[model samples]
Target chain A: MCVLAEEGYTGTADVKAFLAEHHGLALSDVDGHLYHHLNEEAIRHLFRVSSSLDSMVLGEPQILGQVKDAYGYASEFKSIGAVLDKFFSKAFSVAKRVRTETKVASSAVSISYAGVELARKIFGDLKDKTVMLIGAGEMCELAARHLLNAGVKGIMVTNRTYERAVKLAEEFDGTAIRFEEMVSHLKTADIVISSTGSPHFILKRDDVEEVIRIRRNRPMFFVDMAVPRDIDPDINDIDNVYVYDIDDLNNVIETNLEERQKEAGRAEEIVVTEVAAFRRWLDAQQVTPTIVSLRRKFDEIREAEVAKAMSMLGTDDPKTRKVVEALASSILNKVLHAPVTALKNDGNGRDPMELVAVVRELFDLTDGGKDCE
Target chain B: MQTLLLKSTTATYLVGALLYLYFIVTLKERGARLGRMFLLIGVVMHLFGFGMRFAEAGHTPITNLFESLSFFALVIVGAFLATELRYNLRVLGAFVAPLAFLFSLLSAFQKSELQSLNPALNSSWLPVHVIVLFIAYAFFAVQFAAGIMYLMQERQLKGKHLGAIFKRLPSLDVLDDINYRCLTIGFPLLTIGIITGSVWAQDAWGTYWSWDPKETASLATWLVYAALLHGRLTVGWRGRKAAIVAIVGFLLVVFTFLGINLLPAGKHTYASIAR
Candidate 1:
């Protein structure tokens, strides 16, 4: 969770105290962690988060889209100013560079996604196929969600606890079937993702053979995400029926993990180069105000001298006064040129702030005593 | 002019078959589209040539082997186009278009000179029996192609080898559906063709049933499909089992139509019937 706020504003501390007072929980009570990233660190951290290099599943593609949505909402509410706006847009481009230059997000690294990929190979299109979840485990629900996103027609969830089944069904807007009648419902299922705690096989070869007959031998895919295995391995032998246990999914995920590790190293290199480029932009931004003030001070003195010469010469001719004013302005710009150029050219391996301070001091551009440091 | 058209039809079919085969190997949709376009053009040229031949022969041009084979190729490609339009089975062209090209090539090699119709085949039922039976064979040919695809995909699934071919083939369910669809249509046409042929036999030879090699072979093919259709409707025999039966039945259809014609024991031989 990144917070884009004004300088010197300690919103993180305020949020921690608010949580303690309102929720009766200390900041550390929930194993909560926070990091405050200042100007340069903030840019680098945002690049990592949006690129998904810092995620639990490295190179997952969803984080960049989520960050884009959050940026959209913050912009709509006018929460961010010019600095944050530029920072976020730069971060988005950096994330895109990481994605295309590295092979990080090219494969399915999660069990649920792997199941979806396998199901597509069997079923062609899942739009008209039904998925049945035999238990209410988190893995089962997650696999169901992935199948739903893949466009399965409907979901049927059955758990040992009827209420749990009903709760999960409502979450997916699916039907809740009785656990005992789950076998009868198997005929309608094209894909079954089962993760039950039963000590034995919930779906055996004979049970699936009967169901396949009822289905008129339409292909059925079974994803068994259980420890002891809720679906029997022999079920795979039945024609038009497939069973993929947790180990198969783990094998796929492990291979993808190995591939992603190699790509992650490449992605980190991209982040480093991008952070350096953004740092140069930040250095330029830092000296802009000093340059603006220095020019303004020189113009002020030039204007005073021009008005004094015009009044003392008592020149009533408008053309003569214009010529004097133009000369004074030209001299002011010529004197300010070299210092201003040095301040703006920040990528030369020189400190821009030191240059800004010297220019300010030489011209006495700072307030009398307030901003002397 | 008709000979030129027939020769062009053969060339077009060859090109189309090659394009579809390329589509299969490359997994490219553009090749399939171009193949379909060539097939459509070939079918048009084939129909035009058949019409001109009918005018020249003063009867249905299916009186000889060359005409029959060419007509058979036309219907097979026609049936495939209809199936593709209905099912979007684009990849099937790779399997099916080559069969059409083979038949057309065989037709092109035969004696294509126009000959007078046989006096025995002068009755109106000649067209009804032969055309109906050829259409059935065409549909059966399509079912055979789909069955092969089903078997290939089922092997990929059963063997757990999800390679490039697996991705190119249609799902088991869709291929099975095509099999059943072709069976339901082909079986009835085949039944009608057999009944009409027996009726025409009664009028032409004073016998409703004779054990001519062609007649016996067609009956055997009929029985194979009848059992397949019955098994599918009743016991729900589908997927690998159904695909195997459909393939075997089509092989029998091929033998009844082509192989039996080569045997001298049949009165329905191209030499005996046409001369």
Candidate 2:
């Protein structure tokens, strides 16, 4: 069977077509099979791959984690059977090994830093600069620490949860402000890092414009690290009010290729090695049923011949019958030896099922033949 | 000790940048591989250069603006490498390699004249503060890449330019998630950097919160991201608008890092390092 990875597949139709053309399996057929085979353990594995379980950042280690989880889950559920199970399990183990051995998850490179760095570029020294942290989540805490480290004068953490805000603020040695006073703090803050999980803009354009007025022409750097984003997009149009969301940081991140190239070679080698091992295990699996069938055929032939011989020597000694039985078994083994070796040595070519059928026909094994070979 | 290695490394970076640009235009996977190889070579050279500089300086190479900027770029590259390994985002190399090369070039042009540390910058906390701050900046650089990708991906989705490159890029959701995660991690580092720098300033200069230009610009950048994070969580601000905000914030960081340093009136003058 041809093995094709679904990675480069783009459109839904393309994926479906490729699976059908290459694997002779329709998308719908695999869809039900895939989800049905998924259990709690599989879900947990998926989560691990997605990095939903990591302490610093979820989904950061997701791709490898997902691949490993899929393999493990497939094996445990017996969805892949013995052959596929071995193949998938090996892949998962390799991925896990790479993750452990490499320094892939060391740095927390991100957009929030981009926001802070941009502020630094605008302002020469962060010392004595006032910062307003709009959200009290982990994102805010991180941004707050960055600003504080840059010599920002003070930090004010505001969150929906008063206790969370208080906790974050205390940890950073900053003040905890009520969510209601967010705008008041905005008016004074020279920099703001927002990562609230709200569904709407917390800082409206008008509200930010008013704050800009209060702060005079002094620039206010706004870093919207939230997904839905915390500040109004229109706020970006406001003069001296610089607003940046996630995309702006990409420019800054693109400059690190030189450093990353050093490790890519190692990672690529690991992936290739694992893929080869998985392929071998998959190939070896095809011969198992053939071996079983061949042994059974030999057993059936031996029993039939022994029965015939027993009748011929019925009036003779019992010792003669025992000799005849041993002789029949030895003859059956000699007959099957060459075919068994051929089946084992088929490499990537021979079909095990075809060999099983041939052995059955050769022995003339009838229905309900018991314990052959 | 290894001056030749340093020069060769910088040369390698220049070559890598050209190859990466070719990969971008050609869209060949092999081009990407070649670019990556060049970049790897450059990194080795860059590291060697740093070693030589360190030996000559007799301390951490973060005492002056020139050294600080050089180290800053190095940290950015290091952070980028880690992210690439985790995410398998080789496409980003096309953009990042040039920036690294430019920073190194700038460093190369910088006057290497050794000067004694000023009374205020002589404290033990100086190195720690600078290192933390630079590392934080490196993380922000990653966020910038994610942010840019988010915007490009969004445009592709909207404009129907879902070509091979577009397909190769991560999903908008993934980029957004990564951007937020990076910010979450870097923000704390920045906070600590700011706090420690403040303490150092107080000990040496007799005051903190002087509202110097550098201080003002840093605060502004901090406020912007704080708003972005808060706005995202509490208000559900996202997509194009959020991305635009992130982009603008990064520009401000550049201004603060470069523009404020050039300003003549600020107490945080770039004069010490510019010489």
For model 1, state the Cα shift of residue A175 in Å. Answer: 4.3
RMSD of each: 10.6, 18.2
Q: Model 2, range A1-373, lDDT digits (tens) per residue? A: 1121221123445545666667778677755533211222332333233332322442145565556666666657654433334334554565566555443442234655645655654454678688888775666667777777778998888889989889888888889999998898787788888888999999898898787766644557787778887888778776555677766555444432322344445654655555554444333234555567567767877888888888876656778878998898788788777877877765325344344445545655333322111
Q: Which residue runs does candidate 2 get wrong by more than 4 Å?
A: A1-373, B1-8, B24-27, B270-275
CAPRI rating of model 2: incorrect
How much of the true A–B contact set does each candidate keep? 0.44, 0.00
Q: Compute each candidate's TM-score over C-alphas.
A: 0.69, 0.43
Kindly list the per-residue Cα lDDT of model 2 for residues B1-275, writing each as its tens digit. 44455545566777777777777766567777887788776676667777777677666566656665666667766777777777666767666667767776776666656566555566688678878877877777777877887777655443332343454566555566667776777778878888887888788778887998888898898888788788767655665556677777777777777778777676666334454
Candidates 1 onward: DockQ, in order:
0.30, 0.02
TM-score of chain B of 2: 0.88
TM score of chain A per candidate: 0.69, 0.41
Chain B TM-score, model 1, reads 0.97
